[model samples]
Target: MPLTSVEKDLDALTMTITADFPVPVRRLWDAYVDPRQIERFWGPPEWPATFTRHDVFEGGESHYYMTGPDGERAGGLWLFDAVDEGRSFTVRDGFAREDGTLNTDLPLTVMTFGFEETDGGSRLVTVATFPSLEALEQLVEMGMEEGTKAAMGQIDAVLDDLRSFAAELPVAAQLIGDTQVRVSRVIRGSVDQVWRAHHEPELMKQWLKGPDGWIMTVAEQAPEVGGRFRQEWTREDGSDGFGFEGELLESEPPHREVTTESMIGMPGDPARNELTLTPVEGGTLLTLVITYPSAEMRETVLATGMTDGMETSYARLEDVLV
Candidate 1:
């Protein structure tokens, strides 16, 4: 086991767990910050996790759930209190309801995760402070200690698999839940540059074209919360034309944005898209989480070769950045 020790202080209402990994501190840190990597080991063996939203910055929030073997699901939430880049982070952790809201009936804890380099690898020290002694006892009784150890035990495999999350890889999409998908890519540009490329009309017109034969005809940015944005594309031969428009619900500028998207001429409910940008080792890690109206809609969208088209656009984006 990678776990070095587990300590509990009833007097202080805190529990600390230390684990060592056979990788550099940066590698270890990225595994936790990236939703694509963390979801692989965040839950115990029997209860695999799916993160619908994971934002590692301060004031950010993450919502995830673990599915049991029999299809039972338990949800969780984390409110980031502080972030020190690759070194450490603090969060308010608590149970979440099915609607992704905090479950006030359950106990909440303030957890701090500290990362440091050791002789050959790195170490992670997690300290969780309970609000009361009863809360501490409640969580321990619910198998939090054993469950955490089981979760950490699976991290070694993820850490050793480096190529899967490398910067050179193309765009990849993972199903988060029945109605959500998380699309991830490491764009070959700084975070600010990438954000600008996405928001600026001229820059977007240059690289947001999905495939070789398609051209972006319109790129109207939302610019601010409550604003509306529209994008249209046409085939080279002027036959197939399509467009999408959305209202910006939230904007965090160079870090995060939330928008509602709908096909310009098509019918149905709009999709909620949450985009986040983070600086990583090689470039900017861009994550787009989309929530569809239903599972059928989600599957229909993915079946249209969406990921391949996204990969093509991102490859073009790299050249535009250069």
Candidate 2:
């Protein structure tokens, strides 16, 4: 209930997972960082792991892919946080599209993974905090505990693979795209829930992805042409990065809403983030059209985080909607 061994839930509503492994915290911590060591044990029964890449660090990322024991493949980001050497680190856990592309429709999750040292071995505790109650229940029903166990098992296997696989690969330089990211996702929640999920500041924080210090400044709803729907994204760490700022191009409240321009770090005047909604699946299909005014602007924004960061965000969104 508390999600850890320390507390219990009187409400009996929340879902939290705690597990121990036959290893030391130091060894476990090492396994988490060395992406090469992660691919071995990340999938469930009959689901084998497939590695396209693994990069883990502060501000760095890794991706662990699973080819189902049935030969199905899924990829997501391995972003870390709260990393204490020899102790444990947390991963944001981002999701990727089928062909290993970022699903812009999803926001990253703020999942906390820890490796604590014990006398016998190490105790690993993974707490995936959901943004809402619906999110928490959905994850539990979706077999989050069993799934995590499988993924952790994969982590163990990854450590084994590190022995045979090449350990060192040069990191790739930041690359932005000439192709704009046009993305859409269908969320499975009532219109009110989806509207509340996006329009509420507290709800936004649970899924918004970025480096530390990433915060949303606004989430107001005004249904008018000249009306403004402004949101400023900030970083906890003092990096002058661009965030979102937009004006309500059009709005129909719970039915549909659109923004003309939304930019990162700077005002939406130069850059734009457009959000459109259509009723679908008894919920809504959220589509985003983000336009970076200049090539440099696009590249600069994309340069800040790893691809997994986006994946983890999407997974969180999936967690909430389901």
Candidate 3:
């Protein structure tokens, strides 16, 4: 068991758990920041987790759910309060409803996770502060301690498997619930460079073209929140053209951006696209979570070889960065 100790303070209304791992601090930190790795052990053995969204910066949020053996699911949310890179981070944790909103009836907690180097490897200290003694008691009665221990017990295997979430992997998309999908890729560039590549009109025109023989004719980036942006592409022969336009909803420079995207001339609700860039070991991990109008719309979009096209464009982006 990786858990070294678990302490509860009735007066402080806090529960602190300490665990030791046989890896460097960076490796352990990456395991938590990367959704692909974190989901492996974020839930108990029987209730495996699936993270639909994970943004680690301050003011960000994460949405995840654990699926029980019998297909029952319990949702959770994390509102990031502070982040100190690999050292420590804090979040307001609470239960979430099926619609991805917070369950107000459940008590929320403030959890801080601190990491540091140890003689053998590294240590993780998590302190969860409840709103009140009653909240702490309620959680304990729900087997919080036992479920946490069971969850942490599976981390060793994830840390040892280095090839799974490596930077060399191609663009991959995973379905989230009924109307959402998470697309992930690692660009061989810094977070700033990757973010610029997506925003700067000149740079975007250079590498955003999906496959060969197509050229980007228009690249208009939204300068700020509530601004509109558009991009259009055409084949070299000036045939089979398409475009997309939308308004920027949220912007956190070099880290995250949220926008609405819809095909030009298509009369339908626009999809919500949330983009997050995080610096990982080999490069910057780019995660784009798209929420469509319906499951059918999500399927129709993905069935158009979107992932392959994205892979091609990202590969070109790496070359452009070089």
The numbered model that scores best in TM-score is 1
lDDT string, candidate 3, 1-322, tens digits: 7899999999999999999998999999999999888999999999999998889999989999999999999999999999999899999999999888999999999999999999989999999999999999999999899999999999999999988888899999988778999999989999989999998898998999998999999999887899999999999899999999999999988899999999999999999999999888878999999999999999999999999999999999999998
Candidate 2's residue-wise lDDT over 1-322, tens digit each? 1123433242543344565656656556655543233444556656655443433334444545666555566677666665554555577766788766665555455666666766767776765655556655555566666676555544544444433432121122222234244334445566567667777677876766433456555555544677765555557664554544556765545544556555544443455544444343224445444556777766665676533455455456556667
RMSD of each: 1.3, 16.9, 1.5
Query: Candidate 1 lDDT (Cα, whole model)?
Result: 0.93
**Model 3 poorest 10 in a row by lDDT:** 172-181
Top candidate (lDDT): 3
Clashing pairs in 1: none
The alpha-carbon deviation from the true structure for residue 27 of candidate 2, after best TM-score superposition, in angstroms, is: 1.8
Candidates ranked, most accurate by lDDT first: 3, 1, 2
Candidate number with the higher lDDT (2 or 3): 3
lDDT of 1 by residue, 6-36 (tens): 9999999999999998899999998998999
What are the runs in model 3 whose C-alpha is more than 4 Å off? none
Off by over 4 Å in 2: 1-15, 104-107, 153-322
Q: Estimate each model's TM-score.
A: 0.96, 0.43, 0.95
